[model samples]
Target: MIRNDIRALDAYHVPDASGLIKLDAMENPYPLPDTLRRTLAERLANADIHRYPDAAMENLREKIAARHGLAPEQILLGNGSDEIIQMLMIAADQGACAAPAPSFVMYELIAKWIRRPFTAISLDEHFNLDADRFLQVVSREKASLAFLACPNNPTGNFWAADVVERIASDFGGLLVIDEAYAPFADRDHLHLINEHVLVLRTFSKIGWAGLRLGYAVGQASLISELNKVRLPYNINTLTQIAADVLLDHFHVFDEQATRIRCERERMQRALAAFPDLQTYPSQTNFITIRVPDAGQAFAHLLKKRILIKQLGGHALLENCLRITIGTPEQNDQVLEALKELFK
Candidate 1:
């Protein structure tokens, strides 16, 4: 039987996006080029699916490490960042877990599943983190693990680098600086990694989300410890093949990211014209806006066959809706719909 705590928790919900514009999730709006897709198909066809995946994934790790200027030994792969979060929760010392409230939900959700003590420090009214205050709470709770989602989701902003560095240096336990949105951000925390700090990244937002691949970089010893808890063959044969091949054509994804960044700025300007809405500055590929009525705005967009993330209920995110930057046409359609709704 499941524990009572597990029973009390609601399962994670993913809205059905069938036939809509499909912007509910922060996914890349572009698909692989025909040539690259065909190449991947041929490669996948030749894969030895009859055998298990390469458990070590040495080549893939090396490719990823080279992109970040690190060694393969310092890299650890996971099915997705979610699995790595679970692995960290299980492998780290047994004590309280800490993170900023209104950050990544997985950090708190995984902590709850394991019945570990969890503490969430609230962000200020402007969604800013006070480094000194955060460290004080971590010290008081004696938290053994912490996670920071750079350019945090739903809010779509990053804390100052100095603030993050101060906490990373002061905290005694393991600190995870999650850069899931780094591909779209102004900077990353990779240089902050040392004995007790790790940087997490995913290819999902840039592209290749279907492959479900994510990796972490840290001191070799820390990665070695986390590797023990990782399930064998966690990344399957198809994914391994696809990721290795895709990294070779990384320029395609890099160019696409540049396009998205440009589109994000254009969208920000368009959204600002709406007097009824307040838009937050974003370094990520999405924009979070506060509207007069998020529910009505969401429904209005749905009527126009668009799907977006409506982040309501949270105190800081009240009346807020998150829209992933899409192709120019897709973005135009959304802006038109919003203009109609507000008019």
Candidate 2:
């Protein structure tokens, strides 16, 4: 019953963390403050679980839009940004999708899941976009959607906004600027939002991953088109209530992001001092390092009960490992482990 293409592809895997420091996924390390947790419990107690979620989800949608300076009509909710990516692919039934090679795997993965032809244009050796060539190839391929993971995944570097907008405009298709890491970055491409550009966001990085809420902000018409393919009442009732209450206390996340940025810089400086470990510049909440032997370093860290993302196989990331910015204590532990391994 399954399509042959589906059988040929590997299922995306999440590493087990039964007993580890747990830094493989890019998650906020801090827990909700006791005060907030108590308040949240009180709020969650009020939700009507016996009924289906509000199909419109207008209140929650409005609050999210207000936070981003976008209109409610311009936003489309998803179980997470993952679902929105699927919706984009399902709606783009006519043409191909393109994204930078070794960026976000989901762009190509979801495209193929929907049987959409996909193209992955390679970034330069340092993992930056080669704008002219990327534009040329994507345009030639007649791609209907091009994904730009700003402060892109795995590599964690933001591409030049203007250059990407030009590339998308030239390709004559929708351009999704996946800003999953923008909360930690100093800059963003909101200045480039227009008819052809769509911005994707998720609460995952900001400590709301468990709630499974994400949104797309774009021109009203484009958002409407994507919505047609989205399942209604996708955001559950409890999640909607929790999101509203948490967003009302949005300053907590802002403070957490501030601390994470400081920790990221400190982590990078410490990683740079290690022998045979070169660190990449990052605007995201994680730091990616290239160790002399990623296999050895990864095994050593695993043995020490530290779990970080080992990105291998890609020629560009031959020895790379991405370490999420954890709490101060977690980072210190990782630093200590690196010191022992490097020695």
Candidate 3:
């Protein structure tokens, strides 16, 4: 038999939206412009498949570091942020790791997988950090790690900077500011980094989901410690090329991010006009709205072939539906579907 703990847990589930207007995952719905795509294809076609990936990945690291204004030695790349989180978990194998309840679930799940005791401090009713409670619990647990998702996933709002700064200053363990949605957020925690703090960012949000590139920034000593546990060749050659090309053309991605941010605001304003649905303001690319009956609305939207996350099961998300901000026509379709359901 498998380990009892492993046997008892449900695997992370990804829904099959084979033919639906898929918006469940917080992903960029945009595609690369045709000219760029062709240019990228040419680059990939000529890459050195005969050799292994850059063992140091120095070129990609330099590009990202220069883009973010960090020293290349301060960076460590991951297949995606998940593997980076895994490395942190392995390095923090000394004690419990904590995050807010109703957070990005992987923080808890990965900690549990590694058998590190995990704590999920509950967010307040408004889904903001209960800073005092958070400080108290993590201190009590002598937590070895803390993962905070900025413009936090599922609920989608930024935790206050002052409170996070205290956690950075006071926590007994490593603190990770998971900024998977930073391209859309107003502020970042990189400036707050200390020896114990790391900031995670992913290119997935900027139309690079297929590339699976996420990197972290921290002090050289901290990053080197985390890198010790990283599997060699964790990043593939093709992915390295793709990421570098994408970073070189970051202006194009920036334009797309600008558009997504604009659309997120427009979607938020529209969600506000719904009498029956109470929507929250988000600093991320999606909005969560409370429906009178989320299950029913979720079902009706499914019938209409629109896929969004219905988060009724989590205590914090009771009657809530998380809808990713899609393209303009896609948003129009979602609005019409919701209007029909509100009828």
> Which number leads on TM-score?
1
Q: Model 3 misses residue 288 by how many Å?
A: 1.1
Relative to the unseen true structure, what is the C-alpha lDDT of residue 255 in candidate 3, on a scale of 0 to 100?
87
State the displacement of the C-alpha of residue 341, model 3, in Å, after optimal TM-score superposition: 1.6
lDDT of 2: 0.88
- Report the lDDT tens digits of candidate 1 across residue range 135-221: 999999999999989989878999998999999999999999999999899899998999899999988899888999999999999
Query: After superposition, which runs of candidate 3 have C-alpha atoms over 4 Å from their true positions?
Result: none
Score residue 6 of candidate 1 by CA lDDT. Answer: 90
Model 1 sits at a Cα RMSD from the real structure of 0.9
Residue 146 displacement in candidate 2 (angstroms) = 0.4
lDDT of 2 by residue, 75-149 (tens): 999998999989988886378898988888888889878778999888887788988988888778988888989
Highest lDDT scorer:
1
- Answer with 1 or 3, whichever has the higher lDDT: 1
RMSD of candidates 1 onward, in order:
0.9, 1.2, 1.2
